[model samples]
Target: MSINFHEVKKKREEFWNSSLVYKAIHDRLVKQGYHLIGTIGAVKRCHWTKEAVVRKRFCYKCLWYGIESHRCIQMTPVAAWCWNRCLHCWRIQPEDVGMHWDDTRPPVIDDPEVLVEESIRVHREIMAGYKGNPSADQLMVEEALKPKHAAISLTGEPLLYPRLSELIEEYHKRGLTTFLVTHGTRPDVLKSLVKEPSQLYISIESWDKESYEYFNRPLVPRAWELFQETLELIPSFKSPTVFRFTIVKGYNDNEKALESFSRFVEKAQPTYIEVKAYMFLGGSRGRLEHSNMPSHDDIRNVGRILSEKTGYKLLSESIPSRIVLLSRIDKPIRHGKGCPDGVEHPEKYAPAFSKEYEELTD
Candidate 1:
């Protein structure tokens, strides 16, 4: 029997459009100043976006990781969808309850070109509110209006968006840098990308299947295997790739998982290894206690373990975000205004980005 994709989409839209639970989700997001994309996509101002607007502090990605958050537009192409309901996620929504799309995927999707245009336009509209404020930094506003960076990670799994490659191309054509983060559930989507982002991040919240279930609460089966597929493909990408570990205390943070974690990190040999602490915030608060939040020193200790196991040398850190950066010895951090051309650009020049970080010697 053949599947009716059209019917599948229609049913999904009906569920989202007519449900009050989802209505509440949309209402809350809109009130938070999130601009809707198509019927389901979304773009929102990052708290760092506000800081950059008012010229206070930039996001940790900028201060430590090199991307200028002040000139960044944080968004999600498939904002209302995700595969896992991780306990640490800040965006707690009714739409995220499922592991896959309604039946399969959204019935209606905004064109990649149009969504790109709308994303920038919507972001601009949100920024309009800060224009007349007395405290707003006009210089920052001017630079921000002409966004040079895009963090496609505000909420949801960006890979779920069809034409995601085209979306990246559109941003690149307009001279905007792209940073895409995925939960690693869609390795097939990752493999098919025609145009890679300036920076690609695959989040690894767990090292084993048991830890994955306990910490991630994936809505679908074989979630761990799916994540592994993405992990194995990371080394082959044309652009700079990263494996991000969002560690929650007493979940996947113990030494028991460290050896498995080391084995996985060897696959991508990412340019940077981010050992980030999970914060107790938003919907996560309802599911986990504040005690679950890890301290900076805790993350540091874990970073050291990863460093010791993988040979990546510890680099810089942002204490506020409670994250540490580990660099592959020979890779020498390469960053620039736009794409880090081979070195500055994150294209798939395998020779340069070659292998896991292994500089430390004990």
Candidate 2:
């Protein structure tokens, strides 16, 4: 019998882990406690993960709305994959986003079950380091050990993962609240999801197609069409939906872009809108200069413009993270399912305080 060495070699090279370039990245990620899932995904510890345990402070989300930061896991089902090589992105885009993963011919696509199992294990392992820290709070540590929330956005385009719904279900089954962030590139995938995330976020890079293409550098031919489709479906979803904007100064920060953004916001009619500054970090540092990183004041000024254009009340601001929250006056704080600490449910409004941390960073 003749062995097919070609197939074996192909399988081995699929991981890209052996390549010197990828190896360096993998090593650094592992050092920071990132757990690789199958061939193209990863789960990493959130800064809030450690802060929640140490009693320092929760993520702006916890401070804004109310989720136990320690009880949340940060993961991405597709880490080494994305359709847009966004200039402001902080994570490494494994490939120059082309038509789609199928068209891109990714090396590996792991089972959802394995991804979940390994994700939990790696998250726990990362937290294990905090056990010995003097500032660790025993109560919060135990809570952290038993996570109740999952943010499926460590990096990459999660919806690109074929089995993301299953992954979301897995987390939901485990009693964990889930959030799914998409770049509004694949409304077809979003439409098919039966188990929508507890909160759904569509990251809007720019309002105008020209700026959108410039900022996102998408691989697909009609990327703007996909975004428009996503906006159309926003109000139809029973689940709370949000539009997140990562404002990069001198690029998507001009008055024209903001005006266009307001038009898109009106069309989306999302439950909430988060305006955030684009930080200069990760592979983005190569594409954009530090001058591109907008200041908190810069972000606030744009937020003020958006509030005027959309009539979405300015809910709150996080000076440190360079972000602002806006909500429809009717649903601002009194109806997020519960306030100060609550998970939003579909059509089911809770409590009278609504402020969700709009995490736009990787």
Candidate 3:
């Protein structure tokens, strides 16, 4: 069924206020140490934003923060409506089917400028206490309050946003780097995005077409073909690419699937591969049992299998969440060839912060 953007928008607005799906997402973000800054925070943290403080706070605190403050900012494009309803998804509901631009409704501001202004206001209010916290360093606290980077995979398929390319371009102009994640459901939309992100991620949930359909429940008519097309296009792009595999226990966890996935990755030749376990949350609870969540040891074993088969080496593992990052040993080049130093050169590309922030109303 084709999606009706306006009708779906209204339903999504209702869902935002009443659905468990919204609560699940809010809870998950909080647990992951992310503050829902929305659009208001986006304006205040204009130049020296710490985007990572909200989306990847757990990672920032443990790995990137003080040890490598230079790499601290990271943010997600807080929006909704994904192209697929995978059984393993932790943040959405099973009933949430099909694609619709209106997935994130009530909170939606008219334009990017208004959104940024509101973001600054909301962010300041939320982080007011950190201003005087003795344990927090002045610099760190300040950085944490700003929004530096953006991850365009907060909820919905960001590519579906009518002005996604413009939004991305705006972020680049502000000196913020972009990390875009797509489900490979819309090759046309993926190809149309104007800006080149620092890193691009394609979620290849299953090995075979049948498994993909069974697992992802994609809305697009030609989902499999689009997935293949997306893989084929990855090599042509200069940006670093990642193939993320969300491993679910008793599903796509065997050696055959691993071998298939490795072969596909070889074709794509991405810079990094992230293998993560499926957490039992949201609609997945009704479809899958808690036992479906694999243990960290299980993830390690699977990572080893893929590493050996694909000639990739394991760089790190998050034991608690059963996630692993594998890098191609021979491919020494980082995700963004020019971004090796972790510094964003806006003159070379787009600015990271939005220029609209300058005109935001109080």
Candidate 4:
């Protein structure tokens, strides 16, 4: 007799939805601005998106890579599943509420196409609030309704979602660019992707395995080995790869840490590196001190040191976001298809990139 996988998945979904823990957790998440999409997917409005719509201030991603902030849908497939409980992460933790669930995955999965469709619907509903506000830009607000990009890194481990490649493909089919960020623990999933995102990011805040365990607080064993495996696999990707470091003051910014990070950077040789300061917000405020959030100058200092060691050029900096972008090439890779009006005149919007880094760095 053949076992029915769909039946098993349906039963699992029923069990998850009927549990008291799920009800409690779901209620809290709903109140916290996370709109659940399908069975396990979620979409939340980014603060930067609001800034872009109301104040004409874009995020570091927009300033660096031409991603329109207001027109980006920030969604995640596995909203409640993550292998690591990084103290710096702003998302609420299950342990905080005296609850625990499987960190590796959800009880059941949703179809990639359904999740994508529902995500856009929910994103538009969330963005609708701006239309009534007098301060919101009507033109940008209208553009936001038709999202051009999907940021699949909101609050969970995206690689854990089994059908992530299909999800990326679905978004691409709808003429949207996808940006996937992972913790670099799932090499098998990364290697098996039938369709890759427009850009991929591996977040690294720790230098060594010991620091990885301490900082990331990974739930699984041999996480360091898994991370190393993913790093080695980065060079094989066709899409642009990025190493994002969320630098917390007095922790991963020391000289010894930079040296260890340099060794890994040499091995991966990613196209770009983002040195970003950790923001003290949400649940992270409970775990770390206020001083742990580094200033813009501190980010640049660490970024310069890492650039020198890794031979990557310091390309640009976004002071408002407290982040810096470093790249192997001189110019940024711009995507005009997803951008509004099929053009992203970066120089017109981002005046900071006007001067050459040779003069700025010197």
lDDT of 1 by residue, 1-362 (tens): 24343554465457567766666666666765677765667787776677556645555566444565667788887766677878788774554443223422454565676667767877777777787788888776776677777788887778878789988998999988888999989888998999999889888878789878987878778989999888889888877777788888887787778788888888667777889887776567778887777877889999999999999888756555577777785444434442223233222211112222111110
Of 2 and 3, the candidate ranking higher by TM-score: 2
Flag regions of model 1 displaced more than 4 Å.
1-17, 95-104, 329-335, 338-362
Number of the top candidate by TM-score? 4
lDDT of 4 by residue, 259-346 (tens): 9888888999898999988987756877899789888789999999999999999887776567788888776686532233212343
Backbone clash pairs in model 4 (N, Cα, C under 3 Å; residues 3+ apart or in different chains), count: 0
- What TM-scores do the predictions have? 0.83, 0.83, 0.69, 0.89
> Number of clashing residue pairs in every model?
8, 9, 28, 0
**Which runs of model 3 end up more than 4 angstroms from their true locations?**
1-78, 94-110, 113-125, 133-138, 329-362
lDDT of each: 0.71, 0.71, 0.57, 0.81
Reference-based TM-score, model 2: 0.83
Q: Which structure among the candidates has the greatest lDDT?
A: 4
Evaluation by TM-score, superior candidate among 1 and 4: 4
Better of 2 and 4 by lDDT: 4
* Number of the candidate with higher lDDT, 1 or 4: 4
